[model samples]
Target: MMNATEEFDPAVRSILDAAARRPVHERRVSVDGASLSGALAAADADGRVPLIAEVKPTSPTTAGTRTEDPVDLARAMVDGGAAALSVLTEPEHFGGSVENLERIRAAVDVPVLRKDFLLEPGHLDAVKADAALVIARFVDDVGEMVTAARERGFEPLVEVHSGAELETALDAGATLVGVNNRDLASLDVDLSTFERVAPGAPADVALVAESGIATPADARRMREAGADGLLVGSAIMAGEPREATEELVYA
Candidate 1:
């Protein structure tokens, strides 16, 4: 049986070539100061785990939702307590699109992270076109992706599932790390995995908790465990995206 990571084809491209045609002047718009460095500093200063709110309809793992409107949800996230926004740009698996990302970016002032199956330079370029930081999935070659991200002036957020992948992310020069708790395959989260991997992360790196967080207790655990930020979606969308976003991030 193929793991979720192995299922994606080597021949498939992560981004579209048409990205260059988007209005050049419109590529990068203004964003908040909670950037790569800023998010880390703010998370440290506020003593509250900064939030990375996600925008998506459904996933292969969890395929149930309503109103897949990116702009509305993105705005709600900002109106909530989200410090940043993450937009899924993968159309094949996640039903996401560049238009969604652009729409959300145009409507919100927070920093955005282009969450995708980024495996090619085109993907990096596409995220750069929207001026959103790129999340280099653990399955991708982190170093190559990081190099690609920097070449386009986008921050590379290295995501990892296991401790072994953690080293790969650091070697890739990813100053921002997102530890996705959900396996996507097993569709479960082992919060302790963070403890195992967090120790390997250099002090300079900004550690973020991804997936499986529900309440203030969940947020408190991550904050106490030294996670610089938290990236959540399902839980936030469970209630009013705006209401949940506020409670999750600020709680």
Candidate 2:
């Protein structure tokens, strides 16, 4: 049996149930949010892989919760040449909060991706973010999530771990598809995961490699394997944010 934390359905259900209690009207997103897709395109336009540095406070893999201010972290990433930012909003497992997202959005000019166990359309209404992550492993209706994110002015970065999920993402009309190298169930990192699945991705859609990307070599490998961009968290957060971001962005 899969661990409860790793399973997608139960987690998503919990998140949605909690979100339903909040009023959408009070949480409407801003109209002038940054464009995530545009930022990624510009980074890769010069034939270099763009970096989407993540602002993650903690994770199952980390030793402890992050204490650095999110605003400071966001600024460092942008200063280091990161094309965009990914802010974790999952409060329990990741130690992330919506307030972190709000603060980071205010601190950085780059596009921000709200990374969470998101499901409800109202979730988008609750945040003033540029892009949202819709994990393919969890969502029963990928298209619905895509439509909701797009309607709310958020470009959805649909995440896929396998070929089937990639097809689902493509069918859902997702322009930006992220291939997560970490297995949701085991939380294991497989660098080959992206390379294995990226070849099957449609050429037109933007391909982003997420997780387990640390060194410039890792970034170079992902880029060589067809990833136009990278969404990196742990490594960047563990070191000098700006230096890590610049290293990966140019790698």
Candidate 3:
């Protein structure tokens, strides 16, 4: 049988390896007043499933580079009715940077999420976004990371791919959870992954569906499957961001 590290997708393993080499450093920035969970709640109250559009330049799965300015792309998404913005800051594999998140957060009034394979509390301290993604699959102690994020005044969005990880996240006091449809082990996407896992999630916590969503139909499908928010990356980044975002938001 393969060990945990061995089971990781090659791309996921590469990202973790790169993150491990970074120095533990602090780059403190003021937290924006916008709240990710609050945005989702507000959308829910308005009878809308919030769209968390992502500002991703490129990913391991992307076909080519996206040269658009991060701030411009973010503003377009917000103008299209995106409730929040997710800024990828992984740097190596994702072609993202903390500078981009900072710029986008400054450019838009909407909440900004720092999307990275965070492994330590110090990583949270280095960012300045409104929320941080603490992936359960990558961290040894999901609870510890969640607590650390809250201590730093960041809304922690615990991401899990399976039912067991979902339970672990809940046990760790996670109020905001993201169910990623893409499996990190194989990098395969299946939209039903959210439907299968979302039923078990408590109603009080905000649930976000991530990846594998492209059109209005897909957005509606996830909403019907119990998603409070949708986190879309490649689909929005592939073409006209504003129109793409509007399609999902209005869906």
Candidate 4:
């Protein structure tokens, strides 16, 4: 059996290596009241989980979410009512890339969130390419990096896999909390995982669901479970029509 760390996903790595070569400079971008989290909130407020069109491969847990063309699939996601886009740049676990991030950014106008094990300024310095949202999975080193991202006028979409981590994310100044259902350690999808943890989320903190969403019904279940939005990837990547966005968004 492969150790948890051994199942490194290559497609996720290519993009990060590419982003590492970008010029280092603070972006002058500024978002109006509308933000990645805001969009997700707006969509979620409508009683459905607006999918963050994901362009990733099978992960440490998701063993079979592969696509022929991530760029092409990402393009389709925007057309599908994806309030925002979640590009997994961590190849080791998620098989995502920074190249895919750039491609997805160019391919769409909606906010592009760079999903990675963003732990430090060093990591931020790596993906300075073109991402509107930087996903930080709760860390003590986040305050300064959050400042860095916000100074560049980007909203940080922080991810927390559990209630404890959620507190950590909040303490790190994350207004946007993405509750990932798939345990990275186990990689198994427990559909009901977010329910108990969600009520603990601050009312002001926008709650978004991540991982294990395979159908419209799944989206609905999460929405009813108190999630403000869904960070979907594999389901959409599994191949659906552009209009299928309606299914996921309205589910």
* Best prediction by TM-score: 3
Flag clash pairs in model 2: none
TM-score of 1: 0.80
What TM-score, computed on C-alpha atoms, does each candidate reach?
Answer: 0.80, 0.89, 0.95, 0.77
**Candidate 1, number of clashes:** 0
Could you give candidate 4's per-residue lDDT for residues 1-251 as a string of tens digits?
11224342454344344444545444343433237877776666665466777777766445675756777777777777788877877765567777777676776777777777654455564443333344343334556766766765567777666777777667778787788787644456687778867888878988888888878888889988987778877666666736666678766
Instruction: For candidate 1, write residues 41-89 as lDDT tens digits.
Output: 6645765458888886766556476565778888888887687888877
Better of 1 and 3 by lDDT: 3
Residue-wise C-alpha lDDT for candidate 3, range 1-251, written one tens digit per residue: 11354677788788888998877767644464468989987877776659999999999988998898989999999998889999999899988999999889988988999999888777787768789999998888889998888877789999988999899999999999999999988999999999999988888988999999998899999999989899999999998999998888888
Error of 2 at 47 (Å): 5.8
Cα deviation at 204, candidate 4, in Å, is 0.9
TM-score pick, better of 3 and 4: 3
TM-score: model 4 vs. ground truth: 0.77
Each model's total of backbone clashes = 0, 0, 0, 8
Give the top-scoring candidate (lDDT).
3
- Global local distance difference test of model 3: 0.88
Q: Flag regions of model 4 displaced more than 4 Å.
A: 1-34, 44-48, 63-67, 92-95, 128-140, 241-244
Of the two candidates 1 and 2, the one with more favorable TM-score, higher being better, is 2
Selected candidate, larger lDDT, 2 vs 4:
2
Write the number of the candidate with greater TM-score, choosing between 2 and 3: 3
Estimate the overall C-alpha local distance difference test score of candidate 1: 0.68
Q: Which whole-number lDDT from 0 to 100 does residue 157 have in model 3?
A: 97
